[model samples]
Target: MQIAERMQGVSGSAIRELFKLLGDPAIISFGGGNPSKACFPKEVIREITDELLRDKADILLQYGATEGYMPLRRAYLDYILPGNGLHGELDNVLALTGSMQGLDLLCKAVINPGDVVLVEEPSFLGALQTFHVAQAKLVTVPIHTDGIHADELEEVVKKYHPVMFYCIPTFQNPSGYVTGAATRKRIAELAAEYNMLVIEDDPYASLRFTGEKVPTIKSFDTSDNVIVLTSFSKTISPGLRVALCFGNKDLIRKMTIAKQGSDTHSPNLNQAIVAEFINRGYMDKHIEFISGVYAKSANCMIEAMDKYFPEWVRYERPVGGLFIWCTLPEGWEADKLFRRAVERKVAFVPGEPFHTTPGAGKNTFRLNFSAEPEERIVEGIKRLGDLIREMKAEM
Candidate 1:
């Protein structure tokens, strides 16, 4: 059977492809958004599993409602709300397979083929893939430390009047920049003023190592214009595959319809586990431990870049999150440097695929620190820096 034209634009993820190439035992990869296996809280989860089975075996294994287990959804809402400074009744929360599923469902509800979708330039590649699969025409807006530039966004709003604006506002993927409160408020205001839907994908908010906690765009929203998606993959265990989505009830009702048709519901067993984890208050301690490990690793990476990388390979020391965004010196080709780095047993994601505009981020690369130990991060940067120097020599 011939495939549809939409499938042509949808291909294997560049991040996943890079991860595949780094599967060799010899390489240290900073390419994927994998959680550190060390922080899984295996013992606690094991006890929960045993206790749950000993007590509630049938419910643990049986089918659940399309909206999810009511208690689990309620617990999840409570768990995530205190951090964001937003509180709503039980109806506000929807459990998801992962936050990625939530994004897909939102696209299914709001995006028609060829509808314009405004995305941060060099945005999360996965979000880009989701919009691409929905067949939305994506336009790029530049991202700064503050967040998506409001002026550029206003220009796009004036021209295309996009249907939705998608972003990973906090500890944003690939870029490692946090959207400041001012920008967050501005985005909310603009979305309200222009009558555009905003999708905030914040999977890494709990990984902060420094600075005050930033508020979500949804916090400033009174007009039901923003949808927020978050996940336990970064904060808790990823193998469980559970996340949360909160938004305007009308939009959420449509998303729930799309979701029911998509997967029926996220796994009930995993939801039960996550609910227990959160209600028991294990998550807070787990995040603190995870933050310490990641903070040390991020610090090590920044320090290595300062000591070993060529002076022109500039990067921001992200206050939190798993990744750092690095820009090569002018005229250096990051894709070529990636090849050399892989040859030397070090791996990273080339920045080209992260952009909505082709070739716009050719001199940039993203390095992840959460998956590897500090020693490995140091060694990897040394190898990558050597490759950078060689690329400069060739130029």
Candidate 2:
């Protein structure tokens, strides 16, 4: 019954566990960052999948290279990277079952137990878990509404001299904050200066509804210390489990070896489908359509919150990404609010799991706006607001 010491303090994803509560048909969930079902290009995917089965089944049904299905690596180079102001050859890319796998593989490839790994104070919970399981000594850098300051980040790097830094620079999870372009460039610089490898987990950059498209940290990685992980989950289909990462060739090779030990290889059929999806010029149009759908849902939720919630509860109107981070009044705990919400057939993620520092984020929680219908979003927010008022009255 001995679990490895690496997993001693690690726990399952709080969001994944929340799916258990979603079995009730009446519960309007805002817990997981689930892209709208409407966002999936079902017809296009069906058409592509059919063609792949008929034409490429021999290759796809067989074991794929641990490096990835070559076409996907190539498609990413041609279609995905250019928009981010990046370019990479095949050796620089690796296909992932999901972007989360990229983090795990990176950890396996590089981290030694107790090595310092820096993260945004409030980061993606899944990534945090991966680091914990890898036994990386987790450290935090503060991020604000404007994202982290380059000078401040440099000070932290100077302090810890970490093995790597993990961040979600654009439309960051839980908080929906975006690190600006100038700071991203500086981050690339800090990585080189300290020989720190920066893991840029950028699953939501393509989801921007407003604001200028900022450059990724990898774009400025002159010393090749930054790696960028991009996913089709938010843009195409999460179920497909297709994602890719571009980085230093040496690092990618190490990760590929690590990936082999884990999944052997990512599913070839899924990689081929996504590769064709990109090559056929379907990616951009699909992003536009889905972005519009999510934008409407986000606006509806915000409008409902404004009309229903008290002024003391604070959050920003997100320009993109699936979440709205809310902070309740000081000394109020959101896990308590979550309990009351579920009783009313509503749900959201309490913010504690997303934070690395002790006792941080007790007053905070995250609401995902991408999963529910517009009307359902309104009703959920109204019910949530009502519960907050009811809980306060009892207090």
Candidate 3:
């Protein structure tokens, strides 16, 4: 059997591969970016699901509009967008199965083979894989401790003239870096000036535990070139696979058409569930509650890393989001460390696959804090740190 040329070099996700190890209850995993099981509002979701099936089963079980379930589109525009300093009409919103589908849809709608797509260095691996399957010419701009530098972004945009720029502006995945408001505005402006499409994947924005809220790039967008992909996977439930993209009406319409052939519209029941969650005044309160849970977890992980790891191991203390990005000393291999750590029943994602640039991030790795209990988090760090020391002793 012949496979498509676009998928020729693409491999399975490294994170998904790590998931197979998670079946061992003995293993303390810091690998996948998963929200804590304790954080899910199971009761509320059950209640919402019951109510929807009781009253709205006809509409939900039937074929939904390719555009989306109408209530979700409105809920996003009226309830969610204004809080983020964005406003859009129904044509601007498209419900997605997950934010992952938003990337695939955008690539289908706008990206042709060989079209340039610029991404942040160490951006979401899922997005990278989608772009790869689309056979895009991938370019990258570096993200620092703070976030993507505006000057570097402009340099890349000017050089590559990319058709799209993908970013996780708030509480970025894997790295947990937040792009500043100024750079965000500059990004919006650059997108307009260059006629480029900016895909702002913001699943972790509301999960902030510390630091001031930054305005989204779409909030600064004037030319309708910036699109915001919002996910309920972190804030609500990943199982539901509910998310939406807000952007240019024309682009959205294209994606909607593309989506018609994709999932035939995101599951209507899931979309309704999210809409009901927002409309029932439970959204903010739930976020506030889970934010506290993740905050404590993040603090626990940080304190453990400080207490257990050697001084030479460097990592950023994330203000928000699930993962803590760590860089080992130069010449150290995180892949080797991962192998050793897993033998001790501890797991983390080796960082090299997260980078599009060849041979980058080999000395780095990412740890997820939101999935495990505090005890597990501390234990995982201790095991990883001990293995690092053992590896160093051999050198």
Candidate 4:
């Protein structure tokens, strides 16, 4: 069979491929955006499994709804709503194999070929790829410490008049920067004014490690333009692949049709398990515990970089999240740095692939501390630092 050009333009995730090289036992990977296994409620899942089998052995094995299991959908509503001061009945929630699938459905449902989609310059690579595959023109908005630059976004809105603004508002991937509440309100206002859709991909919103909690843009959304996608992957278990999207009723209906043709909804058993997880009130308490672990792990990485990395390196002090963005001094290439670090038994993701434009972010990299043990984080940083020093000496 001949291949499609769109599929040709799409490539495997570079970070996922980089992770495969880590099959070598000598390597210490700071690359993958994975939570520490210690943080997962493994025992709780085992208990859920046992109870599910004992109570409803045959039903757990049966096929389920296209929207998802009703009990689990109801449970997800109860899990996310109270904190945001928003309440929704069963009509508002749609479960997915993962939030990533929700994003795919949204893209297919909303974006037509050549439709403009605004994204963060250094956004989540997966989102970038999804938009690219759908044949949408990817326009970038520069990200700020507080949020995306409002002035630049205004210009984009005026210029391209994009169909959607795809954003990871809380603890953004690659940058780990949280968009402030004022900015979130502004984004919503701009979307309403421009008649654009807002796809808020907030997988990490509930994982705040420090500072005051900020309300989601959806909480302030009166225009019904915002669609918020979140998941249990980071805070709970990634393996089960359960996630949800809450948005305007019309959009949800369209996406439900899109999903029905796609996978016929997310896994029923996984949804059932997650429902039990949330029903038991374990998700709330588990998130707090995960936050603590991430906070300490983040501190370990920052402390290690401060103590060991050269003064020329620049980086953000992430308020909350798994990774830190680091830019090596000018004259140091990130891919070369990755190669050198791997030689020394350490690894990190080169930053270029995360950007919408090519060649930019060549001097930068992202290090994930959430998955590795504290000692491994420190050691990996130390090794990466030494390699950079050695490279600098040669220059």
| Per-model tally of clashing residue pairs | 0, 0, 0, 0
lDDT of 2 by residue, 122-234 (tens): 98988998999999998899888988888879888999999999999988998999999999989999988899999999899888889789988998899999999999889
Model 1 TM: 0.97
lDDT of 1: 0.85
Each prediction's RMSD over C-alphas, in Å, is 1.3, 1.1, 1.0, 1.4
| Pick by TM-score: 1 or 2, better one | 2
* lDDT, model 1, position 144: 81
**Count of backbone collisions within predicted model 1:** 0
* lDDT digits (tens) for residues 75-172 of candidate 1: 86776776688777666778899888998999899999999999988898888998998999998788886667777878988799888999888888
Q: In model 3, which regions exceed 4 Å deviation? A: 13-15
Whole-model lDDT per candidate: 0.85, 0.91, 0.91, 0.85
lDDT, candidate 2, at 313: 94
Pick out the ten consecutive residues of candidate 3 with the lowest summed lDDT: 13-22
Q: In model 4, what lDDT does residue 136 have?
A: 92
TM-score-wise, the better of 2 and 4 is 2
Q: Tens digits of per-residue lDDT for model 4 on 268-332?
A: 77888899988988887898899988999999899999988988898877778788988877656
lDDT (C-alpha) at residue 389 in model 3: 87
